[model samples]
Target: MEIILVPAFADNYLYVLRDPASGKVAAVDPGDAAPLMAELERRGWGLDLILLTHHHNDHTGGVAALVERYAPLVVGAGHDSHRLPPLGRAVADGDRVAFGGTSAEVIATPGHTLGHIAYWFAQDEALFCADTLFALGCGRLFEGTPGQMWESLLRLRALPDATRVCCAHEYTLSNARFAVTVDPDNAALRARAEEIAARRARHEPTVPTLLGVEKATNPFLRADDPGVAAAVGLVGSSPDRVFAELRARKDRF
Candidate 1:
């Protein structure tokens, strides 16, 4: 499987996945179809599937246009179908969806939204996690509790270290700034922040971050770590409480 990054409305990212063996194509969160269409035309590919992570407008805004153009099979969380564009296949946590040569496991990740979910292609080690997890940050809690978001992050953190975290935003620079404020003494984080700065300076995408790097440097994924907990003044507290504090501080940052 090959992944292509397409920039959408102000900082949002839309991913296009291709299965080499079958020449099958799938798009994740097409916020704007014009760019995606242009890319597809450039590559001479036809869309076959559309995987939606949530019901947010920025993510689903292009779905209607793409569907009208390619008539692709649209998949989304069953619980969120009422709000999302019509889903050809409504799935829930743990459900398997077959692509060209491999399949993906739908992992329920409800933090950014109550019905948000991520698609994990084990064979490709790719995780299309829109808004749930970012490069050096996590999504804002719009419709879920701290505990819920914490548990959701835990599940993502448990994936293989080499997993490519295909998150849907270009917020790494700002996230790195906030991360250093909490994990000030982390050498790995400082180094990663510098790299992110450099990448953004050159106007390059700094996402599709490795899960291992995120575990080591992303403060949101390290709320349970003693250093992160201590930095937030919640050393002895549960990870959820620490997460809540970290999230609150980030919101205000």
Candidate 2:
């Protein structure tokens, strides 16, 4: 399995998952269709599926166009049908989607949006986590509460440490800065911050971050850590409260 990142409209990203042996491809959150179409044409690959993680325009805007062009099978969360592009298969948690000889398990992640879901390809150790988890940060609480997002993060964190997290936007540098503000004492975070700065300086993308690295450096995921709790003046607080406080600070940051 090969994953190709397609940058679109400002910081958003659309991913193409390809099966090298079969030349079949699947698109994940294609916010724009032109780039994806161009790439597919360039590679001489046929689109077999379109996987949607949420109903947000930036994530599903290109669905209609792609469908018109390729007539691919579309899959999305059932509860979000009103907002999402027409789905051939409406899925919920525990549902599996197979394409190009690879399969992904749907994970209900409802913080960014109530019906948001993530696609976890266990065999590839890759997660198409739309806007739920970012590098050193998590998505804004638009529709769900901080507790729901926290639970979702915990579920994702439980995956293998080496799992590659493919987030939908390029928010790593700003997120790293905010993380340092709250986790100033973490040497690991400081080092990661520097690395992020250097990568941005070179105009590089800091995505597909390893889950282990996020566990160590992402403040949102470290709500239970002593340093993070103390920094947010929530010592002895539950992880949910700590997470809420951190998210609130980030909203204002």
lDDT of each: 0.95, 0.93
- Give the worst 10-residue stretch by lDDT in candidate 1: 227-236
Q: Write the residue-wise lDDT of candidate 1 on 70-143 in tens digits.
A: 99999999988899999999999999999999999999998889999999999999999999999999999999
Runs in model 1 lying further than 4 Å from the true structure? none
Question: Please, what is the TM-score per model?
Answer: 0.99, 0.98
> Which ten residues in a row are the worst by lDDT in model 2?
16-25
Across 1-253, the per-residue lDDT of candidate 2 in tens digits comes to 8999999999998999987777778999998998999999998887989999998888988899999989999999998988999899999999999876779999999999999999999999999999999999999999999999999999999999999999999999999989999999999999999999999999999998999999999999999898899999989999999999999999999
Q: After superposition, how far is residue 29 of candidate 1 from its true place, in Å?
A: 0.6
Error of 2 at 104 (Å): 0.4
Error of 1 at 178 (Å): 0.5
Q: Which model scores highest in lDDT? A: 1
Best by TM-score: 1
Q: State residue 86's C-alpha deviation in candidate 2, in Å.
A: 0.6
CA RMSD of each candidate after superposition: 0.6, 0.8
